[model samples]
Target: MTHRITVTGRAGGTPGTGRRVRVLAPAAALALGSALLTACGGSSDSGGSTTVTVGSNGNIFDMPLKLADSAGYFRKQGLKVKFVTTTASTGTSALQSGSVQFLNNSPTGFTSALAKKVPEVAIAVSGLGNPLGLVVSKKFAAAHKLAAETPAAQVAQALAGSKGGVSSANTKAEAGLFLKANGVDPGKVKWVTLPSASADKAALSSGQIDWFITSEPIPLQVQNQGDGIVVVDPKKAPMWAAAQAGYGEVVVATKSYLSGHASAAKKFVAAVQEANNYLATHQGDPMVMDVARKVQQGVPDEVLKSSVALVEWPASGSMDAAGWTKTLAFVNSLGALPDGAKVTSENWTNKYLPAGGQS
Candidate 1:
């Protein structure tokens, strides 16, 4: 049986108090004509100087992508990589607009795009499961004399009882599923939508919402502020169950780009594999602290270190069928995906993954 943890509390208030608010409209659908144009914009033939533009959000989930560029892995692969920073939706837009050759986003986001019939496809799996947490304001928890490390049930009870508000990136499916998995019905809780990681951090720090669901790095940053409490750690739950049955962050590309520059894409995956190897070997290295600090900006070293342990970096950066099936099933249960959305093996391919897998 699936376990549900519910937190009951007030619904709406100033930021930092649990409240429900409106989310912005779903990102505008990209026109196929525009997609065709964008897909052809940055293409260069094989052996030519290939400039592959990529975009990603500022989060620890994307560290491999960043590390690839920072460590000159892209150069080693004979491809010129240009990185652009954008929010989840904008990054999707960039991919659709041909502004980027590839996009690093959660598979949940891609699931929405696929449901809409967008032609984008996943090339490689970057990060797995929803390594996320719900951070509540310590000031608010203290003000109410709540216990630290409340279970999902207690937190859901608190939110349901008091009408408190919760906030998260509405564009990603994991945020909503995380709430639902814990028994905080989206309808019952006051929801505020914060798109960017930076914005969510500000909303939390400024006391605009009582609780916010965020992935690693940001949660670590929130804890460093010494004013927020991590009410749930999805990783330590069960069977690495959280990892197996949770959403994934994937590297995606347009069909046109993939068809035209298959080799460069393969090289890109190899570079990420290299970075994952470095992360595994030097799990406690200070370089990770530096990367986390640079990527998250303002998050402390200790919190970043703790978060590192929570993240599971697969050696191959490839998707497993069982994990994908569980993720799709969970999202479907939440109605986050359309009816009959199956995570079949055909939905993914390792054609672009590194040689001999990710080790």
Candidate 2:
């Protein structure tokens, strides 16, 4: 069932740069044209295999999809999925340009895309448990008489009126929702935008900022380096954890792609279920670690193992409508969404879910 199809194209650029260079715009346009040509240019020769190019941010959340590929789940489903490490924004561009058939990232990114009329829809939930969390420098926590075990709401209150770093405006909005839900005034905190997660981690260690909210393994790294303590574990956050879990990481595809390739999309969704089931039953197995290391390079095995325990995958790869509603409510509350923008559960459908409870 192994079908070899070489995906010849440009990868989406590094994540967290926060700016798309004008000079590269022309090149990207060319790349997009090339992608469209290949996809439409096809009479596939892979013994009827459907190649599903996937654009990803290279985050650990994408682990299950990568694991599925390594386990030959895609092959079993008659698919060849090529994963490209592109920033979320760039992934949207790839989706539009037909460079990739599937996109993986936070549903926040998909929400933004929908605001722009991107027409991408979430087919399945990837992983859950808010990947983002709050971390404070040991000195700051000590100065404020805060213990590593302090409640997250109390920590947010203590950090009020202080400078904190985040990766983006959307990220800041998410932090704001969590803090405000816990009775802290997000307006009181000054949010500094760091270039990347590594930059935020460095800033946190150097005391350049009082506290920052970011996703793992930076939160994991901060704890490992002993420079900070995780004040908020999104999985256990007092008020907003469950809401955040609704749309953490999702597998998305464009409406156009789904219309023309409905069968392939369903197959991909089934493969995701297969992967989630594997993780549910075999978490921390050597095979899981091997796949995790392959997908989340540069991360220590222990951190990867710890992260697995932190995240939960939906057994059926089902979408949560209530959770999705709560997520949009918070995003709108911040006025971070585009004008007249709304994301209902209709934006995500479970029609493609595999039958008989795949998990």
Candidate 3:
């Protein structure tokens, strides 16, 4: 139980401010478009397809939408969807301003934005389940006598004094769900912010963090490199039973756009649903793997194969009420729907509309 503080800290100000800036990124970004932090999301591509853009933070749960772009599902819907690569620390203001047509995120993400009064609604469902894993450094695992099959509560107990590597508060929030479910105080572990993906692995390898939490391939890669052990494999029974009750990723857009552009929105969602269907059937196919590599770029074959298999692509991109009910419980504990969001067994569709998404 040695406390190791990784001193890879970056400055928080223009030149000499040694203090870290503390503010809610999404809310601040929304309040002042000055920090809008744009990566650009929309533009026409080819043929006569309408240009649409979706923002992504590279969570493996977003694979279904990426597959849609690669597999011509977007073309099939007369749309050319572009992905705006972004960080988990930002909000959906870009969607509201029409910089992006859709924002691919988890329920926790959307709820955080909604809590800030950002007017957006989920138009489609993507991946489901927890899609996240807890990777303990090999040394830490050996020290605590932890293993792949360790019970969730036991692992949670062991984390009472440990540092967790997180990309942002969003990652921490998502991980909080897992900790909350395991009856552990999420704040027990000191979260070390490592914004770059490369830094996450490096920090863990250097024994700077006791554990790391992230989705897919990262955990798989860590295991491959022998730097960490998968204590909470999202693919396993115990992990799923504990944390897979909520929506993993959803496609959302602003209410103003959805109100006027229902046709495009529905078409876009249809394409995502089609891609998910194909992914559900052709998971291990060469073409699927190729698309995965293209979308996830730089991921090794073994990692992609394992991640693709484990990442649950919801059939037809639908959401069920029971799943959503659990989602509400785990996400902010309110049975009430997201602001301007409606529900159906199959999908949220245009939840903003009173008549089941019909504008």
Candidate 4:
């Protein structure tokens, strides 16, 4: 390593006067400083294991990845996990630009990437079922005579001509699914794009929105705040049970990155699988509960406890063709899949899996 320091005599010095002196020195100090900051984005360490950044949606749904990190599964696999702050909108682009090595999120980002010819592969799956919950404000529920066990038709009728809070493309799709499943015309509903989870609460509490649909534990959080109650739990819904997709929540890496860091990618999937197993069997355990604490902001333990209990982690981490197909179908139902964009082998695989139960 080398460092060249140039010292100029004065601002007014003539360029031809040779006033600038260059001294060449070893860059040990500079190199040492960089070495101290060992994990730089997705860079590899020459003397040790691979270090990379993985982006999770930072919600309760991504808790399995958080468990992998908090439970030392990443370290066990000799992978240093640095979390990069990413949203549904930016994660895939970050993955494409090499700023993020892996993204643990919904299939939407990866699917959208393939639409533009960006090759990212789904290497692993952690969760199996849809965990979205629909909560309606007290006033709306009371006025509509809605309850958790309300008939689907009544729920749909109650939702008609009501304002619902949606945060992103995903939420809007979820809301659409709720309406379409119950045979309600989507035009009959009004969607308010409330950007944050807190915004979901604020809108509902102020009566700005009648219903809000989102994944746990926001629905649980809303109920805890006494603003509303959950009217739909996807886990209990027949629609989700019939079309549950493992690709609903998965780990994705760019095709090029996986080609070079296949070993690291495999190790990551295995670690996440181990974490998923722990979460499935040990939801009540303090450590499993703590993953939510690490990633989620203001949600409480009781809410997370109930929310985690509702989430069903697949026994295996490996993904299959059918699950991807089902997920793609669900996205397509939302009018989300870009035209001519198909989730082919290029966009996903089970080659990196540990080989076990269905996912």
Judged by TM-score, which candidate is best? 4
Error of 2 at 244 (Å): 5.7
Better of 3 and 4 by lDDT: 4
User: In model 3, what is the error at residue 134, expressed in angstroms?
Assistant: 1.2
Q: Which stretches of candidate 2 lie over 4 Å from their true place?
A: 1-37, 41-43, 238-240, 243-245, 320-323, 344-346, 357-359
Model 2, range 1-359, lDDT digits (tens) per residue?
12344534346756533255556668877766556536641123348877768888877788789888999998899887877887866988888878788888676678888988888888888887566667888888888877667866677789888889998876787788777777888889988899888889889888899888877777877777788887777655733354443556888888877877778888888888899888977879998999888877777888788777667766777776676777666567656678778777658878788875422
CA RMSD, predictions in order: 18.1, 11.9, 15.5, 5.4
How much is the lDDT of residue 176 in candidate 3?
69
Question: Which scores higher on TM-score, 2 or 3?
Answer: 2
Per-candidate clashes, comma-separated: 50, 0, 0, 0
**Residue-wise lDDT of candidate 4 within 90-128, one digit each (tens)?**
988888777788898777667877888877888887776
Model 3 stretches with alpha carbons more than 4 Å out: 1-48, 89-91, 170-197, 235-244, 320-322, 333-359
Q: Which is better, 2 or 3, measured by lDDT?
A: 2
Instruction: Compute the lDDT of residue 94 as modeled in candidate 4.
Output: 82
Summing lDDT over every window of 10 consecutive residues in candidate 3, give the lowest-scoring window. Answer: 34-43
In terms of lDDT, the best-performing candidate is 4
Q: Each prediction's TM-score against the native?
A: 0.74, 0.82, 0.73, 0.84
Q: How accurate locally, in lDDT, is each candidate? A: 0.67, 0.76, 0.70, 0.77
Q: Which of the two, 1 or 3, has more TM-score? A: 1
Alpha carbon lDDT at 20, candidate 4? 32
Error of 2 at 288 (Å): 1.7
